[model samples]
Target: MPAVTTKFNEDDTLDMEMFEVNIKAQLDAGVSGIILGGTLGKASTLTGEEKQQLIRETVKMVAGAVPVIINIAEQTTKAAIEAARVAKECGARGLMILPPMRYKANDYETVTYVKAIANSTDLPIMIYNNPVDYGIEVTLDMFEEMLECKNIEAVKESTRDISNITRIKARFGDRLKVFTGVDTLGMESILMGADGWVAGLVCAFPAETCTIYELSKVGKMAEALEIYRWFLPILELDINPQLAQNIKMAEVATGIGTEHVRAPRLPLIGAERERVAKIISDGLAKRPNLPAYKGLSMA
Candidate 1:
């Protein structure tokens, strides 16, 4: 699943037309799933109604070709419950839910928060565990609390401690499907037995991302690593706060997206823009002719 971005107009409103176009591009590129309104999707800034429209439109665009996963990023359990209810209504296949947006709750509070939301809807959930970016760590112990809830289905493992991949696989194995959230560690995560990647740069280079994922999954590391080397510079951008800007820029270069971001996030200015442009442009210049990824298998 490519965790996608929201394209905006200069006035900072939803570029609904580009939004549909981008989703079509993703599907045409053969992505197995699409996740709308996550950290990169700028869900934090979107209003409830906009988010609803986006998810519903996504469900319509997808036409059940692939799973449409919505990120529930509300700050409170009640709001999250409402979001989950909305997702169920919109017919989303899965949800990537954060532990409650700000005000890092203790483990018990966090488990309770997730439990309440899980009970509110039937949509399967991928617990987003990016402690560094999100502050609170959804540790293994907290996951134990979550196991009591059946809807908590997978983990977007962005702990950055790649060893956590090993630990999670050891503990849960098939119980919780694992998808590495950070693009930089995607190769390592797959090698270490992660089920798949919930990616960002795939928005710009879906075929390449899917190729690397398939190569690594099939034990084709040498080829995967070659692509990973060229991809490292681009993947690194996904981890920074400016990812929304960085990815939008790459999308412009790749013809699948635009660089117009919302207010709080201005487009990459002067030097920073130039540097990122150099990386992406240089990458495109030497982009490899990879075999298309056909069978959509994460494992």
Candidate 2:
């Protein structure tokens, strides 16, 4: 596994061509893995068949260059299990699970939710914990309890709480891998002993993300912060749940991918798109030497 260095989220609505382009681009950029149909990919908006196709296409394109992690999220445990099976059948290397939305569940209920998903497949599973999005944060006790599930291999901790990372490292450092889910906290998390980062910003500037991760891995905080500052503005856009949309627009503007997102998660339009474009342009302007913005008409 080589410590599962880098993980990226892909856009679910991208057609096969665009999907292949982005996948190849990220793999070429040297990410350790790809997370298809995750939050950034708008998993909830995708149909079961669509998700399966996306996973299958990604697996074929990646060709084992990097691990492929498929997100299995549905309205029920049964549906999620089915989705997990589809992901495995499609050749995904791992699975990411989110708690069922629309209804708050007790600790016991949460444990059951995770167990059912775990029981569904033998692939390594990583639990996604974002209280703001899922309405529930798996408590430390619950996280520790999840350790009992031999198949559960990782946890994507999205909360800004640094202590949680410390606690998880102190408690399960040897047993389970902990991946920081926030882009801004990546350098610090890596320094604090997280195994890897599941980054949203990597979709647009993977080289920079990889640089930061690599630097942190070797204890070069000074060099890593220099690159981190260059990526901060765009990374800040992720605070809003519409991060995927914003990143898609940046991709379109930077000639990476189309800004077309599925409904209920509309495309950035008018002033919003222009505003994002300006931020990206400004950030690039500040870094004249970085090749990502080379020949890019930031205006």
Candidate 3:
């Protein structure tokens, strides 16, 4: 599952053509699902109508090949409920929801907000428990509280704590699925028995990302680590503040996207651009020839 990037034209309009291109690539790489309108998708910058449009288009394009998940990152409970309603109407198969954005709600408030949205729709929900960037940890205790809501299915664990994966497994077992949202920790998290990855860099390099996951799934760590080590420098871009731009740079280099971010976020420039470009360039220069491992039925 990739928390996919939103493609934009020079005028900052939705580039559905390029967006479809990338989605096709992900589907071809055998990703289990498609995630739209998240942090990488510039959900904060996109209007509600744009997000709904994305959901509808993606659902149509995917045509039930895999679940099309829309990210619900609204600030208010009402808005979140409405978002969920629209997503379901637009054929969204699931929702990747974050805690109340812009406001750090306590555990009780957070659980209430999430439950309200979950109750509004029957669509499955994946909680975005990213305390590192989002500032509110949906602890195991909170997960226990949410167990009653059958729609709240999985978690995109971005706590940056590897032990949290084990703890989640030890606590919930198979009741809740765990997907590491951190790109650099993907292989480790998978090796540690994470169910999947809510990935970022997969926007640019889906083959490598899926290859690593597929390889690791079948006990091929030696092969997986070979690509992972080579992928680390470029994968580190996903952890940066300018992560969207950084990964877009790789996309541009790889001919999958352009560097046309919205107004508040201009394309990366100066030392930052050069530095990121060099990292991507280095990674591309030594890009490993992936073995033809058909573990995940990659196209």
Lowest lDDT block of 10, candidate 1: 290-299
| Model 1 Cα lDDT, one tens digit per residue, 5-75 | 99788777888888787788888777889998898899899998888888888888889999999998888
For each of the candidates, give the backbone clash count: 0, 0, 0
For model 3, how many clashes? 0
Q: Would you list the C-alpha lDDT of every candidate in the order shown?
A: 0.88, 0.76, 0.91
Candidates ranked, most accurate by lDDT first: 3, 1, 2
Return the top candidate by TM-score.
Answer: 3
| Per-model root-mean-square deviation over C-alphas | 1.7, 6.0, 1.9
- Model 3, 1-299: lDDT tens digits are 98999999998899999989999999998899999988899989999889988998998889999999999998999999999999889899999999999999999999999999998999999999888888999999999988789988899999999999999999999999999999999999998999999999999999999999998888888989999999999999999888999988888888888887887988888998889989999899999998876654422
**Per-residue alpha-carbon lDDT of candidate 2 for residues 1-299, written as tens digits (9 for 90 to 100):** 11111122344344777666767777766788889777787777777777777778778888988888987777788888888888888899898888886778888888898998898789999898888777889888997788778999998888778678899878776687889988778888888899999988677766677777876777667767888887888888777767887777666655566767776667777987788888888876775243342222312
Q: Is candidate 2 or candidate 3 better by lDDT?
A: 3
The C-alpha TM-scores of every prediction are 0.96, 0.90, 0.98
